[model samples]
Target: MLHRIARATTAAGLMVSLLTSFSARAIASEPPAHCRDIAIPVSIAQGQPARYRVWGQLCTPEHRPAATVQVLVSGLNYSHLYWDFPFRSSQYSYVRQANRAGYGTFNLDRIGIGRSSHPASAEVTLESNAYTIHQVVAALRGGAIAGRAFGTVMLVGHSYGSEIAKLEASAYRDVDALVLTGNAHTVSVSAQQNLAQLGQPVGQVPRLAAEVPPGDNGYATVQDAQRPEFMYNVADADPRVIALDIATKETNTLGELSTIGDADAPGVTALLRLPILIADGADDKLACAPDATDCSSAATLAAAEQPFYPHSPVDAVVIPRAGHAINLHRNAEMAYCTIINWANRALGTPPPSK
Candidate 1:
């Protein structure tokens, strides 16, 4: 795999973009205390590699890199904090749960979001972001940018991030397995209305000015008032968690917004031979409604998903009462355990005791 990456001639070979001395900024400047920022050179276009310092959190079972690693991708307008969730370390943290289960996780801020380089937002589309993800995978595989190597890699993504992961897997077929969450083929009306509220420029938002900066074009962040309904099931969510989520919201480019309908990934997912899992928050207003076609239970979710990945073993689960932002929900551990357990079985790792 490393050899193929090294020899690739067109927009493939990449290098670490941050200084040899990595910057140790926190994902949310709060206290989960296990993540840092690392930069990588992503080939955004042919001969156009740009330095992007993606922020990520790392957690391994025994304080060492695990044999298998999961590369986590957050959905639109989110950062690595989505997985680490500083709100309540005991309940809302997926990173801690995965770490305790003997799995290594590296969750990153997509190229144009978070502390990563703010490239011209117009240039960072789903397709280009997938390439950035591919480079991160290659860097991890060869121990180039991330400083470690794993025997296997599992790609895990939420919402829009799942789309990028699907594209990466389809184009490269480089990872061992995949896990997708808060996603589905059909876009929901509730989500569409919520998304429309974010039409204003990100730079105009008072809380996000420093993060969005002055030059990037075509990027927008959701209005603070619209976040709770758009991201979480209001009745089931903790008001505090939703507050922090809104405070730290990231930006998404017009490229991501405009090009997504053209990048529907069920067809690509169908071609994957790797183990597959599609887990959704059962009450997700944006992606998985209770009345959704086959979303009532895990069996239904699995049944509807089996056809998408014919060559791979497909599994699905609906985390009860949770919404689109599964990790931020009060019952987040259920979703985290679902993912960690599936990843264990899929990658042939020794299963964790239940």
Candidate 2:
């Protein structure tokens, strides 16, 4: 089915190749209107019931229902669609590739966004968001197919979603590997320096100078740049991703402890022990301190900062004409292909070379 869809769309020519190469049949199956409109009333500790929705097709390769799953953790404002929501028929190609590689995928819609119930004026915090992810992981773990034929689980998180992924790793041991993009913390100086270079100054710099989060500055700078797919999804004009991004920016501006850091490393510093990969666009205005520092070069002396996850080497690629939305950029396939290759090696299942 996927091959036929690819061939059909491919015949349309290169203009359609971007969406078609990935195949389109996976999302062709219509999710029940009700399925697309989920209202999960989840209780966050003693707080109000957090609402969220789960869209996109969840299945395995061979078009059969397999167990192993690829849970997607979204960025600050981007919703699950960036991960699974398919606009074009060919968008399903990403899923088909994952399935072909022997893994199922789940794109999470964090609370207060998407079809999820939106609490009145209550924004989603990292602690709150992490708890929500914990629930999802726990559910999948108990889903009768986890850790068995499913074997191990892998996590792929972008931006704020990467922060949550670190929290999930700290809280959940079932996660075997992590694939993080633009993953930085509140404390990293690189985040701050990058923000300044972009002509966007963070207000908290004066007060929280002693203990501001590593990636906060950089995250802030990156979020300001608008991306289209995140802004315009057919399902909802205002995708929860936009909401998440807004909520995260607001929270960061408020300077609450949304990070998982202490004196030394912000959350993911210790991930060196785990199989991890951190990739960020060189042109990303947010690329700084904890993400990358200046090497011993006269040129980089000004923008110099070392990476946080020293154990897991950061693949700081210079993606030309790319902004914060590296995944959806014209060269996004290159980035995804890199991460996928790394994941395959980490999972002991590298794909066959062409």
Candidate 3:
């Protein structure tokens, strides 16, 4: 059974306000779980001065503590909302689904994004983000975040976020499993086109100007008009989702975009021995093109990515008709089920049906 929260007007308003304010902490009574806002102190690079806090929401099942926790990371121009979307959240929220499946989720805003510290854009890179995430993993294991040590930790990421996850898993090898979505070893022509036209300085965008610290010129955001093309398969997406996505869009760094592909180096993923799941939307033009991985089917995608993780068990899935932001598509639930079911099987933790 799905976990559903009562749709109260006041509750909805509170959620909107929290997001609008870009508060470091937000509390929502949705998903019918035990939820709390968290701030884990981290540094841009290991052994460097600790200067930032990675903010996130930690949600767990109501009846019992979760044995495994999934740490979620979103792509560029996205916040934690990519994993726990607000509109029609019952249907679109991966956090709700994971909680129902008996797994806790920590949805984080990467450094330089919403509610987190906004360092100079030039200071945020894939390696720095990975180092910060490594600290977050240690906090989870050491019972520092929510006062409960999670025995099993799974790192999950989307698009550029996936690149960070791959780097963290390879460099630290601390996570028990890794889930990569909206990503692949090859970059598509459409992806290059979309990326080329999407970025603009955040300060120039009126809506995002107040979200970041003043004088932080290193951040960039996608223009509202270009978001649909950059993130959605319009035919398979709802107009409302697109509108909300654009309205709530966050900033990413120039440093990140320049080094986003660093994780795709020849032997980066080869170092991971943990179970890995690779998933992407079937219609994800950003990952599927004539020269990119053949995302026509799950089998083909699995075959294409197999060489990258030669030493680990790898599973791949293609959500039909969905686009790059699969979680926001009408068929998002299918993608959620695919991920949860795969995690259950791969990790050998069968969630008791709610």
Candidate 4:
């Protein structure tokens, strides 16, 4: 049956070689055709106008210019690397896959994470984060970040990033399409438990202490030992990938976590009038477990989410045997293909045949 074949393909993709010499050589020899680090200045409200820089990397394809640019946003406790993962770059890097599919990618560190400026943790909320993303989107469309302006913009988000995307798209209605991963209307009990225990003050974690500004103790990160349990399905992931994720993990703020569920408010998602793709890993304990949205298959997931997106033509895909961090999983290639292919169809841009 087709279902059986699909499952087999996912399993096989995970079993593919991790670090062959040939892969390393290919990676070293071929970098992105066009890549640049960008810092966009944004002003957000915290009782007064506060200015900060949102950092990101923009990369385009080698042969032809991309017509549609994807603005990638990471989830809680993750940085820009979540979208363009470094380890096993050949299989797990969504940036590489998007470029190969002829789409430009802007992988960003949200205002309070990674290379971006760290404002007082209390100033960083879902609304402020969404406003920051709005500025980035405006900058991209106005040709402020790169010399070239992108007419078609797609917002791609994972987990908490997905929530931000929902808020931005609803509030601004600026993007052409939405690709939301690791998110749904329902939250699993396991996800709540993981969230409740996942974070500790940034100052307490030696690895993250230097990353935050002095006297600001509001940023938090998942404990290194608990990361694999919270974010990955060990059986379907590479051990090296897990180690790399922990080593490169980033911070999330208390403000961001406090209002994380704001985007799920009734009538918010229903305001959008664009093509949307909701993708999640079947084994993602955070979003696909008991009492959460049914992610057993695309149809089931889409049906469950239809009420939330009454104005958009929404499609869903459930990656098999993967966890919360879909891009870091061995079968990430499938997830990449699914997203790129859906974007192509939604935006009317035909992808080059693989």
List clash counts for every candidate, in order.
0, 26, 0, 0
List model 2 lDDT by residue over 1-354, tens digit each.
222122212211322332343333423342321112223345544465544433333455543444456778776545666564343313223454565545667655665445443332223466566666666665566653223345567778877677777766765556777776654343246544444344233334332222233444432222355333222221322344444433433223222123434212455444434665555544444543334433222123211212454444233233334445555444555555455555665677644322
- Greater-lDDT candidate between 1 and 4: 4
Instruction: Let me know the TM-score candidate 1 reaches against the reference structure.
Output: 0.84
Clash list (residue pairs), candidate 4:
none
Those runs of model 3 whose alpha carbons end farther than 4 Å from true positions after fitting are: 1-31
Cα-based lDDT for every prediction? 0.72, 0.47, 0.82, 0.83
Candidate 3 or 2, higher lDDT: 3
Candidate 4 segments whose C-alpha is farther than 4 A from its true place: 1-31, 46-50
User: For model 1, where is the 10-residue window of minimal lDDT?
Assistant: 11-20
Q: Write the per-residue lDDT of candidate 4 for residues 56-77, one digit (tens) a residue.
A: 9999987688888999999988
Model 3 lDDT at residue 107: 92
User: How many Å off is the CA of 266 in candidate 3?
Assistant: 2.1
Worst 10 residues of 2 by lDDT: 3-12
Write down the TM-score of every candidate. Answer: 0.84, 0.59, 0.89, 0.89
- Report the C-alpha displacement of residue 193, candidate 4, in angstroms: 2.5
The count of residue-pair clashes in candidate 2 stands at 26
